[model samples]
Target: MQRKRASHYIPTSTMELERLYRLLVLAILVNVVRGRFLPGPWIYAAHATFYGAEDAVATMGGACGYGNLYQSGYGTETTALSSVLFNNGLGCGGCYQIRCVNSKYCYPGSPYITVTATNLCPANWARPTNNGGWCNPPREHFDMSKPAFMKIAFWRAGIVPVAYRRVPCVKQGGIHFNLQGNYWWLLVYITNVGGPGDISKVSVKGSRTGWIPMTRNWGAAFQVFHSFQGQSISFMITAASTRETVIAWNVAPPSWKQGAIYMGGQLG
Candidate 1:
């Protein structure tokens, strides 16, 4: 009778082990290729210009399409701006923290400004022109409001090269829920949000109601007709960028003040 010999495992060398580890990492990255391809913030040499109530036509006809830039433009202290990039154009409602890195027109000090994207940059306004315009040569340009522009650089320095990054809206006191409408109807304006700040949907719950959906009235305002109108309000808000819901428990009391603001922290 012939005896069969058993096969033994071969030890791998250090180099071979390293190669396998590298291969494993590559595989993991390949598996998440879709996420890798997802859109992210990109840098631009935007020529920041000021725009505000003075501008006749914004890309969305003054909707600003995203977060609440209305507060920023109220009377100037809270500056705002617009960008030429598609992600930064009208309806983007994205927030950016911009700093003047290095520019011939940049003043002595380096200043950074966080602004809500509310408009679009005109293709023609890329650089300062002799025709009383200081913007020209489009692409990667920012048409900011006078307030936002002054935050980063002197207005006289018209166009300054800046470094900007997308960041969560600086909701110092978290989210702001503004109550509106009569007791028969429940309405809320979700503002001062962080992250990809634009809101996608909102839902509410009450002592008797499980979860009542709200419709987008306009901009970031949400509305729903429910019997819980004067019974206090608790709602969930979904962020447009992350598609995540933030729970605002009993945010609004039964009183339902028309212009009252309730503070709640964002999803950190």
Candidate 2:
């Protein structure tokens, strides 16, 4: 179960105290009217902006949130995205649903757009006057693709206030496990995680060795001390958002071809 953080605020005046009392009474009355309440996931509201980001095709050393083999222009109309929370490793490869909720730019027929977290937005540490490349801090802000932003509001409008929450990545196929390099020096990239699909930890267990923890090299390719020559390997995949576990037994056999993708089940 998730713990809710406690927050304290200073009271301003008698008017604010009376407003709080009214809100408390209203909450009790609403609960009495409704029976059998169930808690749901939290949804956050924030402002969002747009830019055409091809971060996956980064010329620099920074790896894309996806694997190395990700094509530059394939499915970019929907998938191209960027985020401000890239410092946290868990934020990469995550999915979110954002809807236009406020501001004059939001039209009546706006629909929520689902975007995959791809690149880290540029920080404003250098220029204090900048707004972190359209990412407003202290809130769960998103800097999305042109297609995604247009779906929420008109392109003529620069920014729109939005409400968003983590959602499952509804992809076409199951999770894909890709092996890079040779059998002696193995690097793994697991992709297409479904629900709030931020990978927190990856562990590998070979025939002889116990569970050996893999250090995150970049986005999805976690690295381990490569030693397996012919034995099969199993993997423990930990989902960051829900702390769920999925194990793929013998997903990769020795003599694993470089860039060969093995299909595995995904988190719900």
**What C-alpha RMSD separates each model from the true structure?**
9.2, 11.0
Model 1 stretches with alpha carbons more than 4 Å out: 1-42, 52-93, 101-103, 108-110, 118-141, 157-161
lDDT of 1: 0.60
The digit string of per-residue lDDT tens for model 2 on 121-159 reads 554445432344444344456666666677778867776
Give me the displacement of residue 40 in model 2, in angstroms: 5.9
Candidate 2: C-alpha lDDT: 0.65
| TM-score against truth, every candidate | 0.62, 0.71
User: How would you encode candidate 1's per-residue C-alpha lDDT over 153-237 as one tens digit per residue?
Assistant: 7777766778777676545666778777876787776666666666677898885579899987755667888667556678887
Among these predictions, the greatest TM-score belongs to 2
Any runs in candidate 2 off by more than 4 Å, and if so which?
Answer: 1-44, 53-64, 67-74, 77-84, 127-133, 136-139, 182-184
Candidate 1 — worst ten consecutive residues by lDDT sum? Answer: 31-40
